[model samples]
Target: MGIETYLVVTDLLCSREFPAEDGRSDLGIAGPGYHTAELATSRGTRVADASMREEVMERFHEEREALAGTLTEWWGEPSHMGLQTIRLRTATEEIPEPWARLSHLMGDVYVWEARQCGRWIVLGVADRDPTDEIQLLLTATETDPP
Candidate 1:
């Protein structure tokens, strides 16, 4: 498959004002004293063979780093950044509704979190098959101090 990219943004300010029918604008349910926003994307690559995995991986990293740079410019350095594993399960699996649907693609996930502009921003990327591309998910949430 050729390289494909997707992005989703969720902001309470924008959503509460201008809601999206597809629900991409919604921050979903949040407890008292908290609000959230998010941006997610999928990056797919097209290669003639699996040997090109390295090249595809490089491109994925580039895209992710570029996104990080943008976040840094907008929010300053992240308070926390690291790699973590996220597992995905299939629909047949009795897991959360959201994750169940994503079970077809289960693997390691990378994440970054920061507090900026009065919100907590979370950036994540799910590990994909070396023969394929990657997916990125970003979220920003507002919370009141106790």
Candidate 2:
């Protein structure tokens, strides 16, 4: 299995525990969502408010809750080391503009929270073998008029 890579790209982080859908403590939530807008945070910086539409905020909350559920199921403990690879796939070729905006807002929130407080992450497996090509070649038929 190939390990997926995910780098933390946020300034502040949340360390407190939050309720997942199941009302569990093992599952925690963090986001740069409502924190500083500045790209980088060092010794001294101001935290900015996260911006989003009402509907978008609602969706973000739902997504965070769902994520919490998955986290609770996978790991009893929530920490960054647990997350090395995460999968993100969609039928859509590219994320819609609105969704992209929401993603940015949510991502920032989570990251900020994580930086402020410790965070937990989940790993994922990626397909790295040439099985697809091999299967395609194997399926080719050499016999004629069988």
Candidate 3:
């Protein structure tokens, strides 16, 4: 995925027409959140060779930085929060919507919280399962859930 993924998702969010369906097309992705309460617009693209995990991770970081740059322009600086510890509890615990769901896949995430609007925007990369995909996902949720 590229920066366009971020742009498209942001457009979807701004329009309040989040991909309510689950599937992937070209660079567009929408699906159910790992936790049902949080509906994340997600996309998963498979790696051509699982052995290229290192290369994929390097690319994931590069893409993350690019997207983070755009996000900083829109949401201001973000807090780079660690999730390694949190990932431990995901299996035996129910932490938080996006966290609980994301923890299972990544060690950290970039979070931008627009507290005044009650929303949090998250960007993360996942390569935990080399056989699966090197994913870059943009997701959001309410700061205070109902």
Candidate 4:
């Protein structure tokens, strides 16, 4: 919604320590137990024409890229990744809870391997509620929510 939101989330994402639970900090929130930190912005209701929908998607991508750039300064370049690729790669492995779940939710995901084994730094964008808002999620995951 604002630069501050992205800046704060970027700071949180850059932190080396993983969160103990799903919680809020700054304008966004973190999720180690659940998945990762997330932020959302509404593009008004989706009761619009196709061109307007396209505009919403484009804006979301720009926002995602902006945050992704900040993470890159700390995490280096992310692996431009997709769900099908991940699905195939993890076909023989047990994909982490929200990681698997994220694949279904995200339209775009840029991944950075964490310093901790089996953990990951992920930035995602998706309009889970197209009629309401588009969500930007940043996650560092090592646990599943109970």
User: Which candidate comes out best when scored by lDDT?
Assistant: 4
Error of 2 at 68 (Å): 1.2
Q: Is 2 or 4 the stronger prediction by lDDT?
A: 4
Winner by lDDT between candidate 2 and candidate 1: 1
Clashes by residue pair, model 1: 89-103, 90-103
User: 85 in model 1: Cα distance from truth in Å?
Assistant: 6.8
Which of the predicted structures, 1 or 4, would earn the higher lDDT when compared with the native?
4
Candidate 3: list runs displaced more than 4 Å.
14-51, 115-117, 143-146
TM-score order of candidates, top first: 3, 4, 1, 2
lDDT of 1 by residue, 27-87 (tens): 4323332323323333444444554555655565566566666656655675443321212
* Backbone-clash count (model 3): 0
| Runs of candidate 1 exceeding 4 Å displacement | 1-48, 83-118, 129-133, 141-146
Residues 1-146, candidate 2: write the lDDT tens digits.
Answer: 00110112211113233222322121222222221112211121122223323333344345444444443443454332211112132234454222232232232222111222343232211112212100000000111101
lDDT ranking of the models? 4, 3, 1, 2
Candidate 3: worst 10 consecutive residues by lDDT?
34-43
What is the Cα-based lDDT of residue 72 in candidate 3?
Answer: 87
Best by TM-score: 3
